[model samples]
Target: MKTYTDTGKKDTRSGFGAGLTALGQTNPDVVALCADLTGSLKMDEFKANHPERFFQVGIAEANMMGLAAGMTIGGKIPFTGTFANFSTGRVYDQIRQSIAYSHKNVKICASHAGLTLGEDGATHQILEDIGLMKMLPGMTVINTCDFNQTKAATMAIAQHHGPVYLRFGRPKVPNFTPEDQNFEIGKAVQLQEGSDVTIVATGHLVWEALEAAKALNEESISAEVINIHTIKPLDTDAIVKSVKKTGCIVTAEEHNFLGGLGESVARELALHHPTPQEFVATNDTFGESGTPAQLMDKYGLNAAAIAAKAKKVMGRK
Candidate 1:
């Protein structure tokens, strides 16, 4: 087992800001569009540094998405920033029609995702954004776990011309992955290797998987941690190999248990190698006002929850 920790705590959105600022200087066509939550989305730095390239659309997310799509027509790669719900669900039609359907080069950067958004409650926490965004045709979905990967992904997605949904979170979390790590869309990062069970997770849940693996290690259970950052074009080869070795699986995510990371992994595993699988996520229920840790426990989205699911899956097999 491997231990990866952050130097200190850093929110993934801060990484987005750093990446976007770097993009502003490196890429001339890179422009940012933010709703009222510029500070929350970490777009204030981009707006402050390059005022000319930043567009504030008030509290209108739908219009911001449309403007981003239009900017693509003029050969501009516009990155629209907002909360997860506002970024995807609120402006889904606009994205589906103007961006995904038309294949526009727009970067949909969403922050404060999943149950981790905390205190703001269910209305703000978007556990189904992955399912919604990934369903759209030609839309690329990428969820970064920590600070380093988020920045790297932001930078990488900007270079790739397509309708991309880059999801991060508000609170500080693990910053484990290498700062200069290369991010490949549709690829999964193998954090730890094991033959007992394969644990596939994404977003902040990736850190939970790592923590769960540590607990499993204490119990003498060998567990593999596979970070499925890109939920859409999943790393099928890695998933198959891990499942083939373990013969059982446990999927973890901050999203709902249905139609998100778990379902995607289950569908893939069912087709390739039918195996017993358990899921650690929200039980299709709404989130409540609480701290990140409290919401995780209440929603069944913590390391202990993942570890329990892994044990059950392995025993079932």
Candidate 2:
């Protein structure tokens, strides 16, 4: 079994802010817009440094999407920042018609996603954002794992042309990945190799999956861990290849199981390979106000839940 060390703990939103700041320096055409959450989204630095390029759209998320879409026509890559609920649910119509339908080169960067948006309650968590965005025609959905990966993804999306939904969270997580990682969209990073079971995870759950793998190793259960950063344009080949070797799989994510990474993986397996699978995700339910740790434990979205699911799925193999 391979071991990973946490360099530090940092919020993924800060990584987004850092990436935006870097883009402001490197990409001349890059512009940012926020819907009354410049600081909450960690986009304060970019807004401050590039005031001319930053548009404070107040709380008008729909108008912000339209403005971003229009800016893209002028060859400017606009990165819109706000809470996940507002970024998707509140402005879906604007995004669907203006961005997705037209295939605008807009980056819809969303912060405070999933149950990790502690004390915000279900209305703000936006667990169904992934499913909503992925169902769009040309929308590329990305759910980054850690600070380093989030930063790398934020920078990488600027080079890609098309509408993108970049999702991150509020709570600080273990920063385990390399600082200089080459984040490739639609590419799955296999952290550990095992023949017994494969664990595919995304977002904050990626760290939990790693911890689960470590615990499984202690019980003599070999588990393969794969970090799935990009949800849409998913690395289907990587998932299929791993499951073929293991004959069973476990998927973990911070979103709901109904319309999340687990469902996507399940669909791929049903078509290419039929394998036993277990899901560690919110069971088609809304979240309540609580501490991040409490919410994660109550909803079974942590290492213990993942490990137990891995063991259960392996039994079916």
In candidate 2 the C-alpha lDDT for residue 90 amounts to 98
Model 2: per-residue lDDT, tens digit, 209-282?
99999999999999999999998999999999999999999999999899899999999999999999999999
Task: Report the C-alpha displacement of residue 212, candidate 2, in angstroms.
Answer: 0.5
State the C-alpha lDDT per candidate: 0.90, 0.95
TM-score of each: 0.98, 0.99
- Kindly list the per-residue Cα lDDT of model 1 for residues 124-222, writing each as its tens digit: 998889999888988888988999999999999987878899999999997889988999999999999998999999988898899999999999999
TM-score between model 1 and native: 0.98
After best superposition, candidate 2 residue 72: deviation in angstroms? 0.5
Flag clash pairs in model 1: none
lDDT of 1: 0.90
